[model samples]
Target: MSTFGDLFRVHTYGESHCKSVGCIIDGCPPGLKLTEEDIQVQLSRRRPGQSDLTTARSEFDTVHLQSGTEHNVTLGTPIGLLVHNKDQRPHDYAETDLYPRPSHADYTYLAKYGIKASSGGGRASARETIGRVAAGAIAEKYLKEAAGVEIVAFVASVGKVELPFAQGEDEVLGKEFVELLRTTTREQVDKELTRCPHRETSDKIADAIRSAKSREDSLGGTIICVIRNCPLGLGEPAFDKLEAVLAHAMLSIPSTKAFEIGSGFRGTQFLGSQHNDPFVDGVDARTGQKRLRTSTNWSGGSQGGISNGEDVYFRVGFKPPATISQQQNTAKYDGSTGVLETKGRHDPCVLPRAIPIVETMAALVIMDMFLKQNARSSAASLLEPVDHLPPSMILPGKNKVVETQLVEDKVVQE
Candidate 1:
C-alpha cells in the first residue's frame, strides 16, 4: 500500500510513463480553502524539463480534481488529484526488453512480477513523486493554519559541494539558518543551471555530472529539511515515533538511500553532555511570555516521539539515479551476455528537483500528526477553533489566578 498516515490518510497510485498518476487524500476536513492552483505550485517545482540540468521530459503535470471537491473547497470526502502523462517516448525503451538496464529495477521488477512496464522505469520512476507533492501542498496549508507549523526544505548538498550553514552554537537549524541557506541556494541555482550556487563548486559538480553523463553513469547527493513552530504532543510514542514516520515517508521515494534526523550520525562524535538538549524556562522573543523551552535543540525538536515546541530537522540521502545512459555489462533473461544502455531522459543529479518532494513528505507527516493530535484531544469533533491566545494566558505566571471552591451543605439527605 502506497498510503501514509492513520488520521489524515493519503494513498498514492499510478506509475511512471503511465497514462496518469495521482493521489487520493482521505480525512481532509471540510470547508478548508483548497484549489487546483494550490497543488500546482508545488507540482511545478518538482516537474521535469523546467531547467537545463533536469530531464528534458516536458510534462505539464497539471492536477485535475476528479472528486471530493467543489467550488474550490473540500467536501469532507476523499480528494483525488491526477497528473496525466503527456510526453512519453515508449519507443526509446525497445532495447530494454532484451538487456535490462544495469542498476535499474528492470531486472528486479521482472524477477518479482515476471513482467514489467517497458517504458520509463514504471512505478520506480521519480515521476511518481508528483502525486506526493500535490498532496503535500494541501497538507501544508492545513498544518500552517491549524497548528502554526511551517516546513522548508532545500538542496543542502550536491555530491561534495555543501551549502554553508549559519554560524551558531545551537545544533538545530532554526528559521534564520534555513532562510540564509535558501537565499544562498537559490542564488546558486539561478547563476548556474546545475542548481549549485557556489560558482567554483557548482562548476566542479557540473563537470563531474557532464563527465558521468558522457560515460553513461549517474551521481547522487543529499537534501536537508527543517520544520518549525510544530506544536507539542503530535506523535505517538513507542510504535509510531516521529522519526520513524519521517523515515518511512522518505524511503518510499524512489532512489532514496538513507534518512536521518537531528544530530543523526554526527552526534556520535560528541559526548552525551554535548549532544543532550538542556531544558530551560525563558520568555519567548516573539510572544514575550514565559514558556518551557530548550536552549539547545540537539534532539531535533522531538522528545519521546512527540514534538517539544522546537525545530525539527532531518536529512535524506539519495543514491545515484540508476538510469545512467552508459553501456554496461549485463545479460538477457535467457542468460545471454550483452551490453546494456539505459534509454529515456533522466537527471544526472536528482537533488534539486527532489527538494519539493522532501518538503511535501515533511508536510504530510506534520499535517497527519496535527490532525491526529486534534482527534485525540477532541472526541466529538476534529474541527475546532484554533487557540492562538498569548502564551502568558495559557502558561503559569506570577499573575496567574487559581479557581477556589466553597464547601456547601445540602439540607435534603439521601
Candidate 2:
C-alpha cells in the first residue's frame, strides 16, 4: 500500500518520472510552525548529485507546500507536499521495454500489475522516498518538540569497510558506540561524503564506491540509526511489536535487505546470561525521579514488545542497487536471452543519501507508535485509581501508600 500509519497516516504519490513526487501527511497536530524550508533540509540531503560518489542526476528537489498549511503553520489537517522532477529523462530507460533488468523490480511489478512504469524504475526508484522524507520531517519536528526525541543515522559499513567500533568484539554495545549514538549529529554525519563519522573509514568507503563505479558495478552497505529519549511503553504487543514494526518499515525502503535491533545476530553467540539486559536503579533526567533502567541494551530499548525508555538503536542492510550501467546477458519478458545495457543515473552505493530516508522512516514508525501509546495512556488516566488494586500490579514506588488501606477496606467489605 502507498499509505502507512494508523493515527499518523502518510499517503505518498507520484513516481520517478512523474511531474511531482510528494506525500499527504494526515493527523499532524495544528499550529506546528511548518514551512517548505523545514522539509527541504532533509530533501536536500536525499537528493541526487550531492557528490561524485552519488548519482549524477542533478535535481534541486525543491519542495512546495501544496496545502494543509496557512501562513506557514500546519492546520491539523492532511498536509500535502510536492517536489517536481526537473531532470527527468524517460527516454534513458527505453531499453527496459525489452529486458526486465536482472535483480530489479521490472519483472515482479509487471507480473503483479500486468503492466509496469515504462521509465526510471517507476515507484521502485529512490525518488519515491522523497515523500517519506518529507512526511518524516514533520513527524520528527513534533517528536522533538513534544518529547525531546532525537534521531540520528550514519553509514556503518560499505562493502566490508566498517567502523572500528563495529569490527571489535563486544564493541557493538561498547562505550565508544554508545557515546557515538549519544552525541553524533547530522552535521557530523554530513561532514564526510560517505556519511560515515570516522574520517579514515569514510575515505576507505569512498575508495570502495569509486572502484565499483569505475567498473559500472555497485556496492552494498549497512546503516545504523539511534533514537534517543524515545518514550517508554510505545510498542503494541501480541502483533505489532516495536522491533517487528521497525523491521517492516526499514525493509520497505528500496534496497533494504535486512534489519536488526540491538545485539541482533551477535547475540546468538552469547548464552542467555550474557545477552539478558539486567535492570538497574537509575534517575530520570527530565524529572530527577527514581526509575528502573537496563545495565545493557541488548534488547534494543524494547523488552516484552514495549520501549524501556533507553536509547533505541538498530541497523539496516542495503543490497547493492539493482540498477547499474553495466551490460549483462539476461532473459527478457518474452523468455528471450540477449545482452542488455542499462542506462540512466544511479548511485553505485546508496548508503550516503539513504541516511535521511532511514532516519525519516524511523521517525514515521516512532511517531505512529507514540500516538498509539499516547491514546492508550490517555484513556487509562481517566479510570479509577489503582488504590483499589494490589501492590503486585502497581509500579514499585507508585501508589504504595494506598496498598495497606485498600487491603483493610477489602477485608471489611468482605
Candidate closest to the true structure, highest lDDT: 2
RMSD of 1: 7.6
Per-candidate Cα lDDT values, in order, are 0.74, 0.86
Candidate 2 lDDT at 334 equals: 91
TM-score of each candidate structure, all chains considered together: 0.84, 0.94
Clashing pairs in 2: none
Clash counts for the predictions, in order: 2, 0
Error of 1 at 411 (Å): 39
Deviation in Å, model 2, residue 395 alpha carbon: 2.5
Clashing pairs in 1: 188-197, 216-326
- Put down candidate 1 lDDT per residue, 30-110, tens digits, no spaces: 988988898898898788987656788888899998888888888999999999998988888888878877777888989
Top-TM-score structure, candidate number: 2
- The residue ranges of model 1 lying beyond 4 angstroms of the native Cα positions read 164-207, 283-289, 380-414
